[model samples]
Target: MAAEPQTTDHRKRPRRRGDALIAAILHATVQELEERGYAALTMEGVAERARASKASLYRRWPTRAELVMDAVYSVIPDPGELPDTGELRGDLISVLTRTARLLDGPAGQALRGLMAEVLPSPERMGQVRAHAQGMGRQMMEEVTRRAVHRGEISPEALAPRRMEVGQALLRNHFLFHHEPISDEMVEEIVDEVLLPLFNTSPVNSAT
Candidate 1:
């Protein structure tokens, strides 16, 4: 009898087909941004670089801000699902610090550059800010749920400012600076700043 052939999980394989055109255009946009910066990243240039049509690019991404944001996301990577490292602090540190590095590194510059252009267009700016806000909110919500699961604090203890602590880490470090936020820095910020500010202090029965 022939030995059974081993099989790899096709689910993990990279799948690119229908989305390839969008991916190619975004990839080209990143190159244009890196070489010519935002000022030169026109629809025509992106079309030329992507070997796609200007009409197609405009139909997909109507505005430069939209084009750049889509492109920037493709260039910079995001962290994977947050694993329970058995402690709330450790878990938040992992999620947030990775987030910080993403912002401080590749994505941040592009985001900042996008904002500079987007701000002039109020409608575009709102959409861009909303887009950014949605991502942070999702991550913070997960962090909060994990904190509750770890029995780190009373559910009510974290209720008031659950997002405040986690997102603030990203807001303060990434939005404000060029420094790559380190794990040690995240630990200190979470333990020193966040815990002290938001972690439950002893409930006094004397009240």
Candidate 2:
């Protein structure tokens, strides 16, 4: 009888580590979200897809929501200070347009899904808002500061409520309209709404 051929075991590959592991997990998470969506995604699925252990995933992310958020944020760029385009209107348009473009991608999908999942829990909802809205306000504040320095707008225009106007409109359109944001809409937002608001003098409460 011929000796039995030895079989190589392929199931015991070395585990991915450090940045490689993180990249694999994040990539797998996004793929799973795109394929299965937030409601159906689980740690087991992500781990299997990443060729990692469940323990590895759990060690990094304590909850499904956190993991999904991380995956989504990984692909999105931080909204650093806006470029000084010389004119306030141009800068505002640039900021709003960039925001609209980001919301048109996987980041948008992940956000919508997260809202649906976390809305029932006040704590989770607050966390999501802090991450999403907080960043938007921060970017707007920076842009507003730049405009002030350039003498494009009065310092009195830099109010908390004013900073939120652009992002609020953008988020409303995104959540309700279910369509890619258009340049016309962004222009309208800048020209019709934000520019007028910033240029107007603040009303005196004592009057």
What would the TM-score be for candidate 1 when compared with the true structure? 0.71
Please give, for residues 34-111, the per-residue lDDT of candidate 1 as tens digits. 787776668888887777767778888888878888777664334346676777677677667766776764466677
Task: State the lDDT of candidate 2 residue by residue for 30-73, as single tens digits.
Answer: 89988887778889999889888888889989888889888987
Best by lDDT: 2
Provide the overall lDDT of each model, using Cα atoms, as 2-decimal numbers: 0.69, 0.84
Task: Tell me the TM-score of each prediction against the true structure.
Answer: 0.71, 0.80
| Model 1 weakest 10-residue run by lDDT | 198-207
The top-ranked prediction according to TM-score is 2
Deviation in Å, model 2, residue 183 alpha carbon: 1.1
Model 1 segments beyond 4 Å from truth? 1-17, 34-36, 74-80, 157-161, 172-176, 201-207
Q: Which stretches of candidate 2 lie over 4 Å from their true place?
A: 1-20, 201-207
